[model samples]
Target chain A: MGRTWTLIRRRLLQAIPVILIVSIGIFGLLELAGGDAVDAYLAVTGGGDPAFAERLRQQWGLDAGLWVRFLAYVESLVTLDFGWSVVMSKPVSVAILERLPNTALMMGAAIAFSACLGTLLGGIAALRKGTAADAGITVGALVLNAMPSFWIGLIAIVVFAVKLAWFPLGGIASFDRPDLAIGRVLDVAWHLVLPVTVLGLAYMALYVRLMRSAMIETAASDWVRAARARGLPRLRIVRRHMARPALLPVVTMLGLQAGNLLGGSVVVETVFAIPGLGSLAYDAVSQRDLPLIAGILLVGTLMVIVVNLLVDITYARLDPRVTDDRVRAGGA
Target chain B: MLKVRDLAIRFAGRSASEAGTLAVDGIDLDLDRAQVLALIGESGSGKSATMLALAGLLPKSAKTTGSVLLDDRSILHLDEREKSTVRGRRIGMIFQDPGGSLNPVLTVGDQIDEVVRTHRRLDRRAARAETVSLLSRVGIGDPAARARAYPHQLSGGLKQRVAIAAALAAQPTVILADEPTTALDATVQAQILDLLVNLVQVEHVALLLVTHDLAVAAAVADRIAVMYAGKIVERRGPEQLVTDPGHPYSRALGQAALPFVAAGDGRHAALPELPGRMAEAGGTACAFAPRCPLAIDRCRAQVPPVVPFGDGEAACFRAGETAQ
Candidate 1:
């Protein structure tokens, strides 16, 4: 337990510099894009007086030097207060927290659905290599992977939402009731169907291919032959010997893909019109809400870091041969 | 005791025009308990295939025709489950490359303990204790510490010892060692062979030792079967096979063994070497006739049946003449 903690701590520390650089670079790009809280405030508030905008800019420290503004941003981050969003007129942290749960809910569902379907299909395909089932799955995965996520989402909405009238095309929940109960949750889920399916299919296709390749490679290894020669039952060989090592590479790939998924969710969320972080970030970009955009970028960066860290810990647990020092060192 | 009769294996050819190639022809072998029988042959001589068939570990694609009897039960007819029950529980196998045979992720102790846990209903603690004891039995030092070490952490010789320990964990009645010492250094090979012989002797287990080296077979085998082109051409006591070979292939192997000695000594003339490679025998009269220097008109026209010599068998029409 102590060793694992040490490993996690070491990994967390190493990620700090990477996250710092990423955040700074994102903040710098947002600044260079010629946007400010004063402009967003004037636009959202329907053109306030010039003096009011100037006072607001000075109050938010937006009228300071770049380094001073960066230092203030870091200080606010350390204080767990990401300043106020000029467009939403709410604390950036509150806005992020409010929207984060929705994104989390969608991502969680997609991951769960994809992992189960992908692993099962991958295992079957690998076990029946060169068979019809394998060929069908390989072709299906190629098609799914090659298709654009937004296009898939739009097509699903057209078929299931507009044409079939089975689901709502936009928004997270039915606008009539906004309570956080089981019925409302189900309604939200109903609306998330197209987006989640699009994201899940895109992600699961790659996982299946990865798992199939890894399993095929592992099956050809000598240890698998040794396991067979030991006279173990076939299922036991697949479950105990072949599956674990094969899944190791899959786990690593899944972790990296999860990070990519968070980034790619922007397109899917916008297409589905779901009020998740991806849609929120897209709205901020269109309105040029600097504070909100920076906050979203920070949140996305943090999500990547946290997910990767969790994956590293999971990897260490699954395969003890992967030492903490190596994971902390990071990347080939 | 174990016996294999009329064993044959045919592999499908890549092209439709070519007939299925016979990897092992009608070969027969018998080994008594507490004795080692060495299957000696070159790479393509069907020695390993015959052993795999006898062990019931042959791939599903290959066609096998034979009766492999372990004591009284015919193993060839058994289903996969029954074959597995007979394999590690009653018949243990040691593969050629010890490094490749052992799992890299597992500790040596866990690997051996797995064998015990598979065949026996021992608890984890009891299985682990037995694993350490088996490790010590295989002559590994610091058995407790060694049990926790993975295969990559150990040397090649140590890994082989771990393999032997795992094989012995089941207390099998028959152990098939396929070139067990081929990958080890000279001194380690000697030690591993000594450990194998001592363990087999003490446990009264039948050993089917397979090797291409005549000298290695001579070192540990009680009876030697020289295989040529998927058939056992000759079977005799180790001393008789080495000193008075009957079949032409056995004679060639024996002469090849002589070159291992220092080359410059004038006191003894160099041994005669066989000419040409062993050609792939098709559906022909005799497999070795193409490579035999003394092949006559009759030798090419007819296959030789197993003829009894002193206390062994030789499949040659002119065994006595060949010996001369």
Candidate 2:
């Protein structure tokens, strides 16, 4: 337990510089893109005079040199100030914070659903390898893996929400029932169903294929054979001896898929019109809101880094052969 | 006593004409308590297949027909469930590489504890204590510390000793060790062989040791069964077989194991090395005839039958004749 904490601490310390560099990179790229916040503000608030635009650039520090502006961005990040969003007319940090929880809720449920269901189904397929079940799952996962999340989301909304009327078409809730908290919560859950399913299905397909191959390989390992030779119960051998090692790959896949899910959320949230970071990122990109874009990029990068770090730790825990030193070297 | 009668194995997905279809063909032997029988042969000689047959550990594609009678009860016909009960409880198997055979994540003590718990009704505490004692019995020094160590943490010989400890946990009447020391260094091989020999005596268990090394079989085995082309060419007491091998294959094997200075003799000069690949099963005549130095027309025309010779058996046509 202490070892795990020490590893976590070491990883977190390493991540500090990576996050700093990523933040700098995001700001530098935005600066190089040559879209001053003054122009975006002018485009949003109707035409303004050149003198007013120059004053706005000076106010937002957009007129400063690239290095001076990047240092200022880093300085603000240290104080948890992500600057103000010229388009949203709110602090960038506040805008991101408002949207983060919704994205977290959708992604959290989606990942949990995919990881669990995929592992169970994949394990079954591997155990029944070369049989009809294995063929069915392999083909099904392949087909689903090829389909885009946005297309799947559109089709799901058409089928279940519009055609069958089983779910609401869009938004966080039935806006009329906001006064009743329970009803509002249930309505929001009902709204989440479509977006979560769309994001989850693509990940589930990859996980099934990844987990099936891993399970088959692990089952054929010498340790599993030894367990059988020792006369351990067949189920016990499958569960304890085989499953744990097989799951090592799945844990790694989970971390890799975390980034994909965030990318996936952009399309899913747009389709469902959910007030999440994905839609916020999309809007910021279209409006060229540099501060908001930089803010979301930082958050997204931090989330991915944290998730991958957790995956490494979990992988090390699963296979004793994996040590903190190896994970550090490999991660680097 | 473990009596193996006419034990033959033909793996599935192959007809009689298919090459390498039959792994073990019509093998018969008996092992008494405290006796060690080594199935000696080169790679692809079906020595390991014969041992795997006894414990029902052969792949599902294998079709085995014959009787493996353990104390008068036939085990060959038992289904998977019943056969599992026989394994570990009645017959324990030790695979080729000790390092690969044990789970890397599990501690040595955890592995032995599991074996004891599976075969017996011991509580967790008692099982742990039993594991420690079992480790000690296998000649592992500092058994307590060794028990907590994983397979990778231990040396190859120590890992082998731990594997032996796991097999002994069942207190099985018979133990099948398939090239147990093949992956170890020369010094470690000797230590592991000593441990196996000591366990066979101290536990009074019938051990079927399979190996490709004649030296290994000669050093540890009481009785040696030399197999060639999926058939036992000779089965005899160690001393008799080493001194006066009735079969040409056994004599060639012995000569191959001889030191450099003793390589020449007037009658058996230029030690005859067997030629050609092992004959596939269902051949009309002796499988070794194609490689035998003493092969004649009749030797290829008919299958050699096991003929008794001085308290042992050999399947050579001219058994009593000295090679010239």
Q: TM-scores of the models, in the given order?
A: 0.88, 0.93
- Maximum-lDDT candidate: 2
DockQ score for model 1, please? Answer: 0.49
Candidate 2 is scored at a TM of 0.93
Which pairs clash (backbone N, Cα, C closer than 3 Å) in model 1? none
Q: Candidate 2, which CAPRI tier?
A: medium
Candidate 1 residue-wise lDDT, B88-193, digit = tens: 7888888889988877666778888888988887999999999999899889999999999878779999999998888778888888998999999999999989
The segments of candidate 1 whose C-alpha lies over 4 angstroms from its true place after superposition are A31-81, A158-195, A324-332, B15-17, B123-126, B141-145, B255-258, B262-275, B283-285, B293-298, B309-311, B317-324
| Candidate number achieving the greatest TM-score relative to the actual structure | 2
User: Total backbone clashes of model 2?
Assistant: 0
Please, what are the lDDT tens digits per residue for candidate 2 over residues B105-127?
Answer: 77889889998999998999999
Cα lDDT tens digits for candidate 2, A223-280: 7887777888898888877777789889988998998899999999999999999999
